[model samples]
Target: MKRVIQFATGNVGKHALPLIIERPGLELVGLHAHGPDKVGRDAADICGRSEPTGVIATKDIDALVALGADCVVYTSQAEMRPQQAIEEICRFLRAGTNVVGTSMVWLVAPQHADAWIREPLAAACAEGGTSLYINGVDPGYSGDSLVYTALTLAGRATGITVSEICDYGSYDDAEFTGVSFGFGTTPDHTPIMFAPGVLSSLWGGQVRSLADVLGVTLDEVRESHESWVTPEPIDCTMMSVAPGHVAAVRFAVEGIRDGQPVITMEHVNRLTPITAPDWPYPPDGRLGVHRVVVHGNPGVEINTRLGLDGVDHNDGGVISTAARAVNAIDAVCAAPSGLLSVKDLPAAHADRVMW
Candidate 1:
């Protein structure tokens, strides 16, 4: 059985714990939390499981690393603290623990990483003979893996585009919805997402990954974005937005080859559905959807809807983000010592037998 430890008890990590506990081939050995409040708590209790797992959450990273687990699911937030996240990941890898999770979405394919980021991770993997794989909803399966899988049916591909159109009003993270995305902020205030090179830093790797799969070399990666403000005040699950405040955002990362975009990943995220009427909407009219369009011979357009048993769109995204990491544990643990990506690992499927 594969022994796994989870880092952090955030939304993704909390949703992923029970999955590890319930999976037949995995054992939950350690739970690591950063804050004092969560430390010393039962793993199951932290995740709200009815029964307790003997493992307790600890703030001791060294102790957790010494547990000799097969893998560490590093689900801590990476966007704001990228350098720190990379340092922590390198530390875990050098301590001989394989890692697979959502931190450092660009690390999904390490080859695309800059020299400063790539060298240390490479050295760590070499030192301890461990591996690291990172993924999530947008840069994860929904954008890269799923789009590549759908391309198999195409005869000749001219252009490819994948879009994640969703409403973020129900998302519970105030810092994320308010400060990061500028959801409740004024129209002129730029959020981190709109910061120069931030989008490219987070998503350019996925664009390049697709290009590699298609055997095309991109001349450059370009970004475009537009934002809309609420005409009237609106309250969301996370925070309240005043009139003439940032409400919706539409952005795209395009891979250009020979001065034309050959591949593009776009996102139309909003706090309310009525804000961006001109932008694309989910076909089924669900709160969330991931759509892929292949512009070529026998062009194909596919739409993926998420919302089950009355779950909200943002909650559904969190579950999927967690599952993407949880399902890849076995594959990552079995891989050779190095940074692994979707291209390096096989298509991971859910353990339906355990269901």
Candidate 2:
């Protein structure tokens, strides 16, 4: 069994720990956390498991790097701190540890990663003969990989659009929903997601990746967005949304080729069902939906939803994101030494371990 470590115990990490423990061909070695509060705690405890695994969490980066594990599942949030996440992952890779996780969305297509970030990671991988792969629910499988897979069935593909349409009312993270996404913020307040080039920077890679797969060269990438305010005050799991505050948002990063949108990545995020009545709704009317449409000869549309075992769609999304990363560990370790993408890795399957 290959030894592996988890880099953080946050939302995604919490969901991943148990899967890593139960999966076949993997042995849990260590758990790494950022704050002193989490240091020295049992891995099982950090993941909310009653049983103990004997592995303790630590904040000592140098010591953790020296463990010489086969891989590190780096799931620390990168949306807010891209540079720090890149640096940390590079450190692990340079230590000859294969790295896989959902931290860097742009690295879902490694070639699309910024030069400054990609160059050092490539150098580190070359020096240590390790590999790194970045993936997640949206940017990884549901958005990029799944879209490409569906396109294969189409005889003549004219346009492709992938969307993450979900309600954020159940999301418990106020900072993320209210502040980051501007869910409960004023209409005039510009969230980072709507800032110039931010949407393109975060999701343009997915659009470009699809174009690359279809052998279509994009002339340029463009961005468009729209938002709505809550008509009445609504109390959500995370924060309260006052009337006239931002409640729903829709944005797209379009890959333009031949003066037309050939590839697009769009998000229709709402805090309430009534917020955006005119916007596109999920086919099944589920709380959360991921859809990919190929407007072509066959006119294919694929939809996916998750709300299993009383878990809300927002949290279900977190679990799916973590699972995608955890399942890819083995493939990443076996890949060629360098930054890898979903296209470079083999199919990831759940290796059920019979206890």
Cα lDDT tens digits, model 2, 1-355, are: 8899999988889888888887878889989998788888999888878989999999888888999999999888887887888888888888999999898787888898789878988998998899998888887787766786787889999999888999888887777546877888898999988999988888888778778778999999999998899889988786788898988899999999889998888899888687788998877668889888999898999888877778888888989888888888878888899988887876544455344
Q: Tens digit of lDDT per residue, candidate 1, span 225-329?
A: 888888998787877888888888889999999999999988998887777788887776687898889999999888777668888878888888888899888
Which stretches of candidate 1 lie above 4 Å from their native place? 348-353
> Model 1 lDDT vs. the true structure?
0.85
Residue 132 of model 1 has an lDDT of: 91
Go through the candidates in order and give the C-alpha RMSD of each one to the true structure. 1.5, 1.5
TM-scores of the candidates are 0.96, 0.96
Q: Candidate 2's C-alpha lDDT? A: 0.85
Return the top candidate by lDDT: 2
The superposed Cα distance between candidate 2 and the true structure at residue 254, in angstroms, equals 0.4
Which whole-number lDDT from 0 to 100 does residue 148 have in model 2?
A: 69
